[model samples]
Target: MSSDPGEPARRALERARQSIQKIHQAAIRHRDPSLHEIADEMSEVALILGHDAGPVQDWRPCPVCGAEPGSHCIQRPGHEMVNGMHPERSRL
Candidate 1:
């Protein structure tokens, strides 16, 4: 067993990223018009899965909870973490 608690998640994410890369390469080799579309979609998925995706939207702080940029907003006392980011935060 691995000692690191996040090892599983890290491995899964890496695998997904690699799969996307392979699919993109295959699409390029085929040279079909539809394959080009698939390649574009895979490129978008790669960007979203990249390390730069850690941040929320903008660099500004959350208007509601004042959560700093790159950090998720804090939930209310009875709210779940999934609901933490305030709707107002996206307005920026």
Candidate 2:
């Protein structure tokens, strides 16, 4: 038995990656918007669990706040910057 405490989490992370790949494939095959969304959510969750998880990538624009990559998310009707990144933007 592995004495490393992180081993279980590592294994789980690998399994999650495999599951995400399967979900992505099914989403592509069915052309279902809901499936695609689910797959995306699963991928985000997996990334959160993975060891490489880090601060949000700033290369893509946010869908909710319309915050462009490398820019802060501004509150609606105002130019003030939000304290933190939008939840949608934080996801993978």
Candidate 3:
């Protein structure tokens, strides 16, 4: 039987979605004490999605304290660390 024209496009889209999902999962798995690394990875993914190609060089720093991208400002508690804190904080 001949294949439908739409089938290839649908399959490609599905594969792309799965690939993005896997990347997001890996980024989650690589969470760290400061989460700077994970944030960078997520930023790269966002760039792939046509979102802001950031955190841009000219992006405004955190106005309250001038914190820059990748800076682990004490005021900005990392989501990954917060989730893993209870038992892992000591190990980190």
Error of 3 at 19 (Å): 0.2
TM per prediction: 0.41, 0.47, 0.34
lDDT winner among the candidates? 2
Which residue pairs show collisions in model 1?
none
What would the TM-score be for candidate 1 when compared with the true structure?
0.41
Per-residue alpha-carbon lDDT of candidate 2 for residues 14-62, written as tens digits (9 for 90 to 100): 7766665565456556655465467566656756665542344243357
Worst 10 residues of 3 by lDDT: 83-92
> Could you tell which candidate, 1 or 2, scores higher by TM-score?
2
Candidate 2 yields a Cα-based lDDT of 0.58
Model 2 CA deviation exceeding 4 Å by range: 46-91
Model 3: residue 16 alpha-carbon error in angstroms: 0.1
lDDT of 3 by residue, 33-87 (tens): 2344444455567567765432222122233334453333234444333331222
Candidate 1 regions off by >4 Å?
A: 42-92
Ranking by lDDT: 2, 1, 3
Residue 58 in model 3: shift from native, Å?
A: 29
Candidate 1: 10-residue stretch with minimal lDDT: 51-60
Q: What ranking of all candidate models by TM-score puts the best one first? A: 2, 1, 3
